[model samples]
Target: MKDKVKGLVVGVLLGSLLTGATAFAGTNTKISVVMENVKMMFNGVHKSTTQSIVYNGNLYVPAKTAAQTMGESFTYDGKTKTASFGAKTGTFKYLDEVSYARIDGKTNRLYFKNWTNPEGLKFTIAGQKYLHGIGVILDEPYSYDDQTISIDYNLNGGYKKLTANIGIDDYTRNSTNSGSLIVKGDGVELYRKDDMKGGDMPESINVDVTGVLKLKIVFEATLDNGRQIDIVLGDAKLIK
Candidate 1:
């Protein structure tokens, strides 16, 4: 998934999690990434500790486990100096003393800062502007990241997420309105908020926030395994 909050402040360090199947932990460095159940062998490739990056107690490889295993486009550029793999191609760019990735032909940015989480451990994307970030729950980074059965090419396994928008109204100088919501840290979320309750939402439950009102919009979601994610709307402003 791409992080859209590029120009905006990085905000606080959000939580991270994986909501899919068991992780594939391996010790062998010569890892084999199976795409749609077919082995993916790179012709001229370099290798590192393929098992160092663990997800859900399993080593995760961004190249094979996340993209290749899911049958997405993967490539690298020594000239442009970037690495892209899977269903999404990321252009590695440096900004504010940190490495950030951007999807080709899109304004969304994917934050690649090193993440240290408790749950089985994996990578994370944060600070999105326009929604489109994807959560990759991999067992062994690349070896088994997608939710598909190789032998029959059928999706017998995967994960599911619940999403909904939030709204709040009635504004004053310093008001504390109800329906104050939040998106859980583990999964994906989108929050739409303005000075009033009736803020703009791509998929809105309500509309029309044109008045002296203090509002808030939250895009709440629940994962398959009873995990909830809360994404607060970008900003909270004063109704002048």
Candidate 2:
């Protein structure tokens, strides 16, 4: 009932803290971001596409995924790389902190910063906001895990829930989520799809799509007193 909606989500590198951080683990070391031409005007609805793919090799251009493809709130800091892009930017909608994306592009599901704990299990981004602040906890903030949240993606066209947009997380145990960030396929719905409140701090929802092909944004969060969490975005996925 109180969702103002700010948005952008994508992250990895969770060492849980930093100090050499296992020299940055590697699961094929993935990274890829490209939103071509950058013309996705939310609040008014505008989507321009030229979509490319490398995303798991580290190449997300179009000015750093254009604030999570047009839903603001960004962050990144993998041991002094630095990247913090608050929400609410206008006049063509832009934000910067030396962006070229090495890391730092704030995530959704309400803020997830300070992470980079390498050898202990794995976590990798430790420089954001200013580009460098190593404390590493890179990944594992869906609330300490019980596990099951999967979301996938792949769409070529179709939309009009007023240009769809959503990602939601109800502060632990309450569970209220929704999804629809245009870019259809596989009936996308990452984490129940519905997150946006007030403005700042990783929250976004802008939907409009009917093109679903390889879109797989899943979710499965179960925790009331028991324990469960597993979420993945960027290729969309969630499990609990």
Candidate 3:
């Protein structure tokens, strides 16, 4: 009787151990994270953050970090679950791969590729191709005197500023390529750049859009004796 009891106890303990191990194995889950390789610079300094992620083909950084990068302040209210930046207030929500703060009042969107003229031409230099449907890229060796591309935007009077990153991307080693960056709205000139040369850093431009109804960005290049004269309007948009 004693031997039988001991054997029964041992069997129960082994069964329990096996059952627990199987349950643990069944509950184990695996997760995958995708990383993107890209460099981001803000205000002439490199900005690094672990919370940056790429979701749905868009790169998103932390709200606070992004605000700080733009030299702006950020505050979050736990009670109302809202994020406030200056005069703008919005609710924050986190998704699987990205997070966003939806503005409470009004917003405006102007994507460069969406506003580019479709009838413009495309060019290629040293096996790198640039399409006009996306953004304006000018690189010609006196093939044309001047090239122009038009972009139109209709405003709802809620936006406060128009911002864009404009720069030159001259691949030619010589220093003969030059051009001017011009922006006009409704036949009124808003912005102009006449001394754009090769190997110049990109500069951020902001124009006040108080009561403007229409907006247009024109990229015109005056090329000299050079092989390539590239100018790109990088990530142009409107801010509210």
Candidate 4:
């Protein structure tokens, strides 16, 4: 039965390509394409459901199928007519993609960085370099108390989880200073680390953010010998 259904689909595709049928977007514009039943594979395993199709000499596959096969999640919004492929199966938003409600930092503001060449946030943790992150660093060292950098993200009680890698940037690896990372949901502390040193591998944070109206991420620099701290929130994202 499955084979019969597959054959029917292929037959239709072939007929449309040969007759220069209109594309699937409901437009009247006629387009010529070539369809093929190429084998699909992912990570050395055969993927039967994700059959390959050739269009304009380019190989295309089902978006949702391919996303799921790559260990990611796919979601579609009918009202907004939007689709998303993200870290979680449902709707997902990266932390850097959103605006910060407030950032009470002693010096620099929060900034987003990617892992691309020439321009990106580069950090090394336990000898592994990460390519994506949101980072902030202090300009001056203060001895009065721990230089606190508090950043607030307004979730508005929409997302269920917040995941990230918290650590110190590799640029400050030579420094003996340390800092701390704290996660708070709706003014309640969810996670905390007292001492995060440079070169130490980043710590994974996956905490429940359900019903969290205001999420606060606090970074405290334990100033030592008048040195600065570079804290990075790597790959921070919200999952719905």
TM-scores of the models, in the given order?
A: 0.20, 0.19, 0.45, 0.60
Local accuracy of candidate 2 as per-residue lDDT tens digits, 1-240: 012223432343333332231233367553333332334454676744533222445523333445554554556667867655554222121111112112222233211222222222211111102221111111234544322333222233322221212222222212232222223245444223433221213333333333443443333333323332212122111111
TM-score of candidate 1 to 2 decimals: 0.20
- What's the ranking of the predictions by TM-score, best on top? 4, 3, 1, 2
Estimate the overall C-alpha local distance difference test score of candidate 4. Answer: 0.68
Tens-place lDDT per residue, model 3, 59-174, is 54455555555556766666876665444522211111122122111112112233223433332223233332223445444444335444555654545566555555434324
- Candidate 4 local lDDT, 40-131, one digit each (tens): 45556765563455666566655566555555566666688665665424567888888889888553345576433335647555555655
Q: How should the candidates be ordered by lDDT, best one leading?
A: 4, 3, 2, 1
Write the number of the candidate with greater lDDT, choosing between 1 and 2: 2
Each model's lDDT comes to 0.26, 0.30, 0.46, 0.68
Report the C-alpha lDDT of model 1 over 1-240, residue by residue, as the tens digit: 222212222111112322333323345344333222223233324322232233334433444333443344556555865556444312221111221221221112111222123432222113223222222121112332122111111111121222322222111112222123322212222233333222323232222222312222222222222221222222221111
In model 2, the runs with Cα more than 4 Å from the true position are 1-41, 47-63, 68-78, 87-240
Could you give me the TM-score of model 3 versus the true structure? 0.45
Error of 1 at 5 (Å): 21
Give the CA lDDT, 0 to 100, for residue 120 in model 1.
25
Query: Which candidate number would show the highest lDDT if scored against the true structure?
Result: 4
Please estimate how well model 2 matches the true structure, expressed as its whole-model Cα lDDT: 0.30
